[model samples]
Target: MKKLFFAFMLCTATLSYAAEGTDTTSVMLGKNKVVIHNDSLGISVSIFDSEGHQWKKTREVNFVDGQEVEQVFVFSPFIPLRKNTKRTFYPHFPDFYYGANLLNANSNVVMRDTKSSEWGFSPCQIGLSLNKQNTLGLVSSLQFGFVHNHFNTSSVIKRVEEETCMLPLEEKDVTTSFLKYYYVKLPIMVEWQKRLGRRKIFAGGGLALEYRYKEVSKYRIDKQKHTVSRDLGINALGINAEAYVGFGSVNLYAHYALTPLFKKGINAMPFGVGIGITM
Candidate 1:
């Protein structure tokens, strides 16, 4: 904007010099035509749009040393240079989303099949629009969530020595066994939005840093439940890559864990596909 204003002033000064030589003159600045009319009283400059509509006119009196001189400067009231644009703030985080979680393992690694799922919600979110149109922006938010790893059969997750390992349930009556993680995540993304008819659509992708604060393992043997809470050799800090596209307030997203799901031994990656809604 500053550059544009300077360019306008520079053009005005150059036009003022030219106005002294002619009683009536017209010059084209890009698409707009500037007309200068000089008479005995003073000089008046008029700016006409591409359609030849006159939108602005100005008359001026100049002072040189002790003598008074007349001059005129015309500027467009509605500059074609991104008129009526300003930076603004909005909400960018998804209010709620649920997804199915799965693990991808190396071909050489042997792991049991289990059903995993995750759900999360953003309690606080904010975005800063880079321009007046609000088409491009930066978003940051805090998400609190849980991931549950449920064993398909009678099995439980156990940490032995320094490795988290899966073990089959010794009790024949065991019906369910699962591991759950509670986490807080911080995500930052650059988003682009577009208007389609009356609907607005957006797409964004970014990195999220997550801290898994608590871990719980549980198993139920014929109504008898056993629960344990402890560090299970899992990675405390996790990095995730996420992308989403949506129209209006709803979006579909995919998330992939960039870092390993565990600290050591297990070479597995966790990923998910989900739908989210923004407030």
Candidate 2:
């Protein structure tokens, strides 16, 4: 908005210099369309259209500074209006286009696929989808994405297995710390959207699947580490529900992870925000 206002002001200021000695002048637009004649401070323009209406904002009447006087000729406004006419318009796009955002996710929780209560990144997989957002609406796109989570955690296991705990039997003692199953994933949610606003507002949803490349779990005791990892074929996948608002190609979005990020019985809620662009 500021840029547009500044541009308008700049054009107005530069008009005087452009006017020069060219006082009495006329600008003609094709046959029987429109004509503009100008002097120093005054402008005169005429339009007699046989059919369609042609319009230009400031582009039409850029009369330079002149004392002779000028009359602004907004020919298009004078032309008769048409009911149904098809016209195409191009929308502005960002430099990196749509799918070029460097994204990263962080959290405060131990990422345990079985326990959501652990303090850590609950999302075993966080990724961005490119194919999901090809065109702003109803068009296909390629999605670039990633998923990563890891934690070196130690929890007091005395609740169920106090006998095995090194702490005093009557009081909470040594805590059992473990570096359990860590997984890094990359996946895409191929999806589409419906155009909802003049500023590119849209709402859509899609499926996101993750392929885990690494997984390992271990228990640490007295400087000694032991393996305690489990496997579930990287089932860390779910449906992505989203809502968004945008301008041109730029957009801001929020999403909810409907599927339980971890196996049942874990305490975790997955939600996130992101900045995106339309391809």
Candidate 3:
């Protein structure tokens, strides 16, 4: 009989305590429940939040194809998501980025004969960075790229009259010449990206140094050299800028070439578009 009375008293006390704490949230300490990871190229940003998860945003870094932006805090409002905070935020980017560039040029280095040939190179890139806490942020990135171009050039040969025993043609004899060249190359760039509003429209500019060792000319005589001065531009240095519309994993980008296509203006303005990936 005494044991029963004690058990009843314990149960009544437990009920009273639950009633007192019913309307208040529990206070627990730790990191957010989501997981974060960085890619090797580092030009991207990504996040994953599962149900019943919390996080407090920690250190965030970004890379593009292995190159990273020099500066970090170019965006605004630094309210980053914490590590242990709950994963209730939507409109977040997944963990991958891949894209191609349609247009290209060598404004400061080599030049191509056709204006349309500048549209030959197709560049690819990836991005990894943290979510913007406020409206502004300090974001860094890396970028790598390459181009494959194939084109032909034809020029008219003027007529000339000559008195040489070997030549029935005149010194001003009319003739024609054509040349074709093929090249493959790669470039590396580093730049910062800024995000605004929910749509995340941002612009970034960076410098890339490229190397091209494969510019081979096909001669009229397959067995003989085409010209005494047959040299392809192997090493070229230049600059480029890009504007992108950010929507998590998808980004619409517009790119431009700041340098001329050769030692002189052999190639004209170069630009093009494709898809881009953000982590």
Candidate lDDT values, in order:
0.71, 0.36, 0.35
lDDT ranking of the models: 1, 2, 3
lDDT of 3 at 59: 35
Candidate number with greatest lDDT = 1
TM-score, each model?
0.63, 0.32, 0.38
Over 4 Å off in model 1, which ranges?
Answer: 1-85, 89-91, 106-115, 131-133
Best by TM-score: 1
Which should have the higher TM-score, number 2 or number 3?
3
Winner by lDDT between candidate 2 and candidate 1: 1
* lDDT per residue (tens digit) for residues 1-279 in model 3: 253234334433443466443332222113212222233443222222332333222334444554555445543322344332232222222123233333243232222333222223233333333344433322333343434332222321111232101112222322222222333323333324434443454444344443333333332333343431224332255555545455545755555667643443234334545555554
Model 2 over residues 194-266: C-alpha lDDT tens digits?
A: 4455444444444434322343434445566554434422235554554445565675655555554444323
Give candidate 1's error at residue 273 in angstroms.
1.6
Q: Which stretches of candidate 2 lie over 4 Å from their true place?
A: 1-142, 150-236, 264-269, 277-279
| Candidate 3, superposed: residue stretches over 4 Å from native | 1-16, 19-133, 152-231
